[model samples]
Target: MQNGVVMEETKLEPRVGVAVFVLKGKSVLLGRRRSSIGDSTFALPGGHLEFGENFEECGARELEEETGLKMGKAEYLTVTNTVFLEEPKPAHYVTIFLRAVLADPNQVPQNLEPNKCDGWDWYDWDKLPQPLFWPLEKMVRSGFNPFPSQSHPLHSC
Candidate 1:
């Protein structure tokens, strides 16, 4: 080896994540995450932010990718910096949160990626399902109200 030393091949860098806070009436759209860090926990629709992607674009793309429902232009909501140091492989992510109204009221969320998500469902924001993903849980605990006015849809799935 050069200089009688070895170098690590990989570097640990913080990743950018985007999550959408979609609300249907008093309910918010969330899915059960099947990830290594926060497995079996409920989380908003989101994914990694790709290179050269703006926050809004990344949020929209990830939302549609995770859930078959499309959304109109997104609006900034909040952000969360979470570090999973206790996990087997420590990870860090800066998650930018956005909220968007459903573009198509008829477009129901489908389990497109069953491998990464158990499924999607609508849950009351105040009474969310247990074991929330870290970022989302942090947002909830902060008492942040993304939507001041809740649209109580006459019918929801």
Candidate 2:
């Protein structure tokens, strides 16, 4: 309590989040977040990593949960240490970036969680939507690319 006002005592920890890069040709799948944090901003399909889940498992789960599309497999791309200092509830996250291909090229993406996201859309890497989510914006600023390259190792089955 401060100045006779009761304050909730909550533990703050860096949450582990997975962001999947689902590519189709030159476009990548993105969704507009509708939640309190990063509201109305384009971001990759992903969410927090559940307990007892590996990076790949988390990525696959988030991808399928957020967007109605099944990914073949995901490869580790990079990680971002994000810190939100301006939000009402400041938070930190260790965001793991993964790349994957759609199981079916013709499979369309749908908004599975309307409460958290608006809808899914494919955008070219060079022409992404404005107001990107924090992690994704940081990734672009750091020169991170999701395109398939021979330089980076891929994990596929």
Clashes of each: 0, 0
Residue 24 alpha-carbon offset, candidate 1, angstroms: 1.0
Residue-level lDDT tens digits of model 2 in 40-133: 8999998899999998888888888878798886788888888887777889989988899988889999888999998999999999999999
Candidate lDDT values, in order: 0.82, 0.87
Error of 2 at 140 (Å): 1.2
* Model 1 Cα shift for residue 146 (angstroms): 2.1
Q: For model 2, what is the error of residue 145's alpha carbon versus the real structure, in angstroms, after optimal superposition?
A: 1.1
lDDT score, residue 100, model 1?
78
| Model 1, span 1-157: residue lDDT tens | 4587886566779998988888777788989988888999999898899989988788778888888788864677767888999777889999888877788867799988999999999998889899998777777798877664547322221
Residue 23 of model 2: what lDDT?
91
